[model samples]
Target: MSSAVDTLEQSEAYMENPKLQKYFKNVWLKEKERWVSMYRVGKMRVPVGTNNGVERQNRMLKECHIKFQVDKSLSGLVKVLHKDFLPAGYKKYIDENALASDSYRSYLNYIPPYLHNRPPKIVKHCMKRLNNASSIPTDDVTRVGCTVFKVRSSESLLEYEVYFGSESEFPKCSCPDFKKWFLPCKHMFAVFNKYDDVSWNSLPKWYSDSVYITLDNYVIKTSDYNSLKQSDIALSR
Candidate 1:
């Protein structure tokens, strides 16, 4: 178990209830290699940690579409869901209404240079995380060194260490996002927020580069793909 996992497992007695123990043993424990660590999950760059986010969005869609007497045909519904429901709700609730909140409006304008080349989805994801980090009290962030800090979580009462390394090394966090995915997690952002000097320039190269390029390979060698094949050279035509 130790060899397969980077972190320690919860205590055996923590799941002592028979029902909880059975589920933990049969499901979570058995699948520990896949989901136990943030490192494992982060490498995949999965946009979701759980289906709840999707489910919640879907529920919102249903409420908005159904209550408003919108078109019901499958195609019409799909179009309205995107073109009407989601966008409208986002603009009305999150964006337009955001002007009322100083913090929200500030976050909207706060874009980093490295994020400029990223896809819109990735930008939004980072923004969401940044917003979350903002909610954490700045006083909770304790600097230990020029490049290291400890962030105390208000809700969980847990402390995560963040390291903003140099050119030879990327920034990292003791939290799972840094440990496994190599991406800066909210805790790292919280520490970064404390500094006026920090920007996406401090981010790992992998974060700003397109993830699709990382996932797939495309090679065109001058001697191979670019150069004519021997058979083509030999052909009379």
Candidate 2:
């Protein structure tokens, strides 16, 4: 990433434009950490790299719900959204099985089929990466300790260390992807396939906490307002 930036800095087009160069150095360089995914951590690491979803939803609201009507008053718009749009969207969500009853199960009650306990989206990502894990040569994955393994990258031929920690700590990997995303990488999955003893306890609490809050909030909103307030308090702590 730095190399790419350096190359851009040296380009004739960039050098010729004084304002562009000033903007690049003063704004882009200074704020790179905010925009760059590699510098993000914790919840920011989730794969929300694009605003396409927001843009699409906005487009839907304008085109479908408002029907490009610009003359509606504030209350009129709210009435349309509350009475016509939101309910329709909610019904569609339920009809599509997006909000399943199983999703509302408490952490203690939820027993994931996979070794690691993750949100469905993350589980799907890991399932896709399993193919890459399978392709890894057994010789490439060297067990360093009971909780540590070194897996060589297929593309770069660089060895990255994968660390399996307790339930309180997130499993770590030396790979750039893991460092950037704070999520399990292919190397971690490789270790999981190799070792039978590693269980769901190896996963961090953050994912489970996030899942619990999201599911519980969704169910509690209409059923129990006090429970929602309690959930908020727990989250704040």
Candidate 3:
């Protein structure tokens, strides 16, 4: 099957080096899975075909490398990455359009967020969350102060004001799941996940940033449209 490496090799038509063929051919042949990965996503205009795109991507990654190295933690990097992907264009989500492409889901993930134009406020909170929790675990979270929470169900949303004194230890989330089954509830995590930093305008606009709204996953790619055949891509070998 034609793959990304094949595409890269194909693009060598405009190149001067014959040695590149011998070298990349060896690399491509050795890496069977990595080779065919690009067809799995419809995001990038190209994967390995041209030099300009790759060089630009590398330069962007280097900037991220600098930020993370200074912060000294991977979490800051991840949070920063999250904010970077916030809506401002420059992203291609995997919807029906992305799926219509032949091999768009098997091996591809989204681009690293560093390349996007991040706003100051969002990125400011991101850097702080990263800097403060740089030495801690992802699940190794901390909480302080009080915040309001709204719990939603099928019928209604319940509002609760959780209070923690200035010197008191932050309480675990009072959501039914955390209270009854000892799980990490969204509200409990939200109260302190956003860094209550010194700056006000720079503060993040989310308490639910740490919370995720996810549906159950299936072994196969689920689609709402039937224009394309529905094959079990989970086992597409």
lDDT of each: 0.58, 0.63, 0.37
**lDDT-superior candidate, 2 or 3:** 2
Tell me each candidate's TM-score: 0.43, 0.63, 0.19
Task: Give the per-residue lDDT digits (tens) of candidate 2, residues 35-73.
Answer: 776565533354665678879877888889898666588
Candidate 1 clash pair list: 39-180
**Model 3, span 103-193: residue lDDT tens:** 3433213211331122223333334433443343333333333333333232235443333212233333444434432223343334434
In model 1, the runs with Cα more than 4 Å from the true position are 2-113, 204-237
Writing each residue's lDDT as its tens digit, candidate 1 over 128-232 gives 777789898889998888777899876787899887666556567777555655555788778778877765556556544545312111211111222222221
The alpha-carbon lDDT assigned to residue 165 of candidate 1 equals 65
Q: Candidate 1: worst 10 consecutive residues by lDDT?
A: 213-222
Native RMSD of candidate 3 (Å): 23.3
**Model 1: lDDT of residue 195:** 78
